[model samples]
Structures are given as C-alpha cells and as structure tokens.
Target: MRRFSRFVCIDWSGAVGEHPPGLALAMIGQAGAPELIAPKKRWSRQAVLEWLHGLADAREDILVGLDLSLGFPFIDRGSFFPQWDGSPDSARSLWECIDRLCADDPHLAATSFLRHPEARRHFRHAKGDTGDLFEGSIGRLREVERHQRVSKQANSWSCFNLVGAGQVGKSSLTGMRMMHRLEKRIPVWPFDPIPDSGPVIIEIYTSMAARAAGLPANTSKIRDLATLERALCVFEADTPAQLDRVDDHATDALLTVAWMRQASTVPALWTPQLLTPEIAQTEGWTFGVL
Candidate 1:
C-alpha cells in the first residue's frame, strides 16, 4: 500500500455516552479546501465500515493515520496489572480492534498523536506543592469520564459532543496533573508561545529498531518510550537539514535527548552522553528507555 502524501488528524471520541445529531468527517488534500463527509445518524456499523473501506480503497499509497490507536496494550504492572482476568472478547472488541491488540499484546501500544515538541513542552510536570499531581490528574479524568456516562444531555442527545467531552477531560486531567507536579510548571499545550514566523518544524525521530528487528508490528515490546526515542534519533540523524525548519537550539536539544535515549538499547552509547551525569542519574530513568 502507498503511503499518504498528506496528513490526517482525527480528533476522535468513542461516543461512549452520547451520539450527535450528525457525524462529521473532514478530509483535506494537499491543495484546495477540506472536503466534508457527513453521513446519516441512522447508518449501521457495517455501513460505516463499508464507507471507510471504500474510502481507503479509493486512495493509492495514502498514509492513513487514524485518530484511534489501532490496538490496545495489556498492562502487566501498576494499577492495571494481573491483566485480562478472563475478560470476554466483547471487552476487547468494544475498545476497537487496534486498542484490543494493544491490550492483548504489549507491543502495539500507540502514542498520542500530539507528540510534537510544542505539545510535549506543554505536558511538563507542575511545580512546588503540587509536585505529585499525576494521580490527582488521573482522578479528575475518571470524574470527567463518569460525568459523560451520566449526563443526560450528553448521553441522550449530543453524540458528537462525546468527543468534545473526552478531549476536555483529557486536557483537563493532563493540565491539572502538570499543574500539580510543578516545582515550576510549564504549559502542556503552548501553541501561542511559539512564534508564527518562519518555518519551525517540530518532530520526534523514533527508532524503528523493533519494527526492523522483525518484531511484529503489534508486538509486546514496542510500547516503551525509550524505544521510540531511539527511533526518533536515528530518523533525525539520517534525515538531512532541509527536512527540518525548527531553530537550531530547539532542534539540538530534541535531537540530543533523542540520541541519548538510544542508551536503552545500547548502554555503551551512554559513554559520550549529552546530559550531565547527575541529571541523567535522576531524569534518565524517567524516559523509560531501559
């Protein structure tokens, strides 16, 4: 299959609670205006799948980026451990085939689409008293999820609004977590802080080492952030400067960190590290490269 020449950004909502009066699909090409594809509220899942199938069939070598993770990841540790405890296939299917894959296989977990440098900058931890806000932030997200489930206006009426609610909840939770974690907090989504002038490209050069190693595309080992960092480093190093438009300072920091992450796969790479030993000793572990 041919990759898509253009980008496809999906702001998706699982519609766990509400259904909007109409479904909206916006398709933008390299040139010209965006095309809207809205189908009736009565369309069945089979019909929707058929339409999507046709859409995909029509495109040649298009890089079809989905808003949803193609699969689910099976959390082996932490709060969600003990794993799938005899859960039926329905749970997996309801979560979407890709998400289910991620849940069943550890390797297929996908990163959030908002991975640009600007986006990552905004996701910094909060400072001072709220230094450990990740937990609270998650709690807030659970609350938001609960609200969606019970809100009549949301559940009975506006289906499309489900996406809005989910986005709001996620943003709220993530932002709150950032604020709570602040010894000196940074913005989690600062588009305005960046200057609009000039072509400033933000990227994450992820390593395809796992993929290249013949690891299944949806394997259990591909979810580590460290693995992704290595990919990004390799990707950035191999690509020429013309491909990037960001300022040298910002690009350097990003690339350096990305390269440093290669240590996850090769400890010897740490011999000539860019980050200070002290900082690396503390912050390095957080990158999950190991």
Candidate 2:
C-alpha cells in the first residue's frame, strides 16, 4: 500500500491598509483530505511569527503554502535590518523573524531575504489549449484575453495591487521568510499548482461559506462545515479519526464579518492547494477524493 502525506496551504494576502501580508491557511493530507483553519490578520510582525509558531506546534509535518516573494530585492544581506520588534511602522520584525529561522535551519540555508528567487517555476496553473485559466472542458473555447499570458515581473510589480507604491519590499521579504521556514524542514511548500505525492490542495472557500451561515466553529448543526472538515480526511483510507474540537460558532461569525466587510474582491486569495500523493509522481489533480 502507498503511504500518505499531509500538507498545509497558506494563501497570503496583505492586510488592508497595512504592508503585512494577509494569510489563508489550509491543512491537506492523508489521501488528499483538507482541513481549513481560521484566518487571521494583524499589523504586528510578532503576531505573524506567533501564528506560525502556533502552527508549528500544532503539526510539525505540515507543508505551508505561501503566496509572497521570499527574498531581499535591492539590498545586500548584512546591511538589512535584524531583530524586528514590530515598532515604529517598520518591517524590521518580519525580516528579522525570517533571518533567524533560516539561519537556524539547514533546509532554509539556501539564502536570506537579501536575495529572492521565483516560485512560479515550481508551480503553474492549469491553462487550456487556448491558454486561459483552464476550465478543462473543451468545446467552442473563447479567445484568450490580453492579461491571460503570464510573464515574470519583480515581486513589487506583481504585488502592486496589494502593497501599493512602497511595499514591494515587504512582499519579497515575506516570501523569502516563508520559503526559509519551509527549507528548514519546519514547514513544507505545498502551494504548487501541480499536485505532489506528499501534499494536497486546500479548500479555503469552505471556511468562508461556513462564516456566511453564522454557524459555530465547532457545531453539529452546520452540515456544510462538518462536510468540509470531514473532506479534509477523505483522502486517507485508514485513520478513521477523532472529532476535532472546532468552535463552529466562532468560525461562522468571523467568516460572516470578513465577507460583509467586502473581503470577496479576491476570492482566490483565500484558496490554497496542498501537496498530495499524486503530485509526487504525476502533475495533475482531480477533486473526487481529497
């Protein structure tokens, strides 16, 4: 029998009116099942680090998916700031967090935030023959749009829609930090568009759906929430599992607030994909199992 692996998908977006990236986290594993977690937003770097620390504590084998640039773009490594305290409207704390973790972990020893690399090479979206976000069904396809073809650009340029004029650096730094953590083996990168033998895609929209109905984070009444959470374990043939202590009420409330607040502008921002058994030997994925 083939062994199963679990994955975590972390879809990151910058916080509103702040340079810090907003994150969407998903835990996928055991035959392609996915478990969605509560989303969080904070202005403090310490808060970001603490959140990651908590995740690390919860599941050490989790593969974290990040959607930010993970390297220093225009400066030397030594001159970059260290020991970020999250004070005075600066990204120092965030940078420092990445620096320390990468420094301590061998997998993350590749480099620091001083220099960044491209993540797309490791992942690509499914595009149809006409070259659109592939719908996979081929029948009288529509013409391609001007923006359909993706090209490489600076992280700052890519995230210009979120970070604004001066925050590209933050995007790059955050990406570097995320990769560093993954490289250190503390976390794994599972955001690749292609499924991996070790990870699976995360169903982030379910959480939003749960929040829409005002269901409890851990309730028996919300059938959707229960199904979604259970879907996280469907891929596994073994490990029947135990009931997780989920606060369904809280989850519903939070998702409701986020949607009402117009967080839907970027629905894809909340969706994440995990590494799965299929991805290890192949590059395609289907939604039938996990």
Candidate 1 worst ten-residue window by lDDT: 183-192
Specify the highest-lDDT model's number: 2
Clashes of 2: 40
lDDT of 1 by residue, 146-252 (tens): 33335411211111111322233222222222122221111111111222221111111112233333334344133343443444444243322232223222223
User: Worst lDDT window (10 residues) for model 2?
Assistant: 139-148
> In model 1, where do residues sit more than 4 Å from their true spots?
1-10, 16-22, 40-47, 69-84, 87-164, 167-290
Tens digit of lDDT per residue, candidate 2, span 99-193? Answer: 56446433222234222222112111124212221122321110111111121111113211122332333444444454334333242212233
Task: Give the Cα-based TM-score of candidate 1 against the true structure.
Answer: 0.29
Q: What C-alpha lDDT does candidate 1 achieve relative to the native structure? A: 0.26
If scored against the real structure, what TM-score would every candidate get? 0.29, 0.32
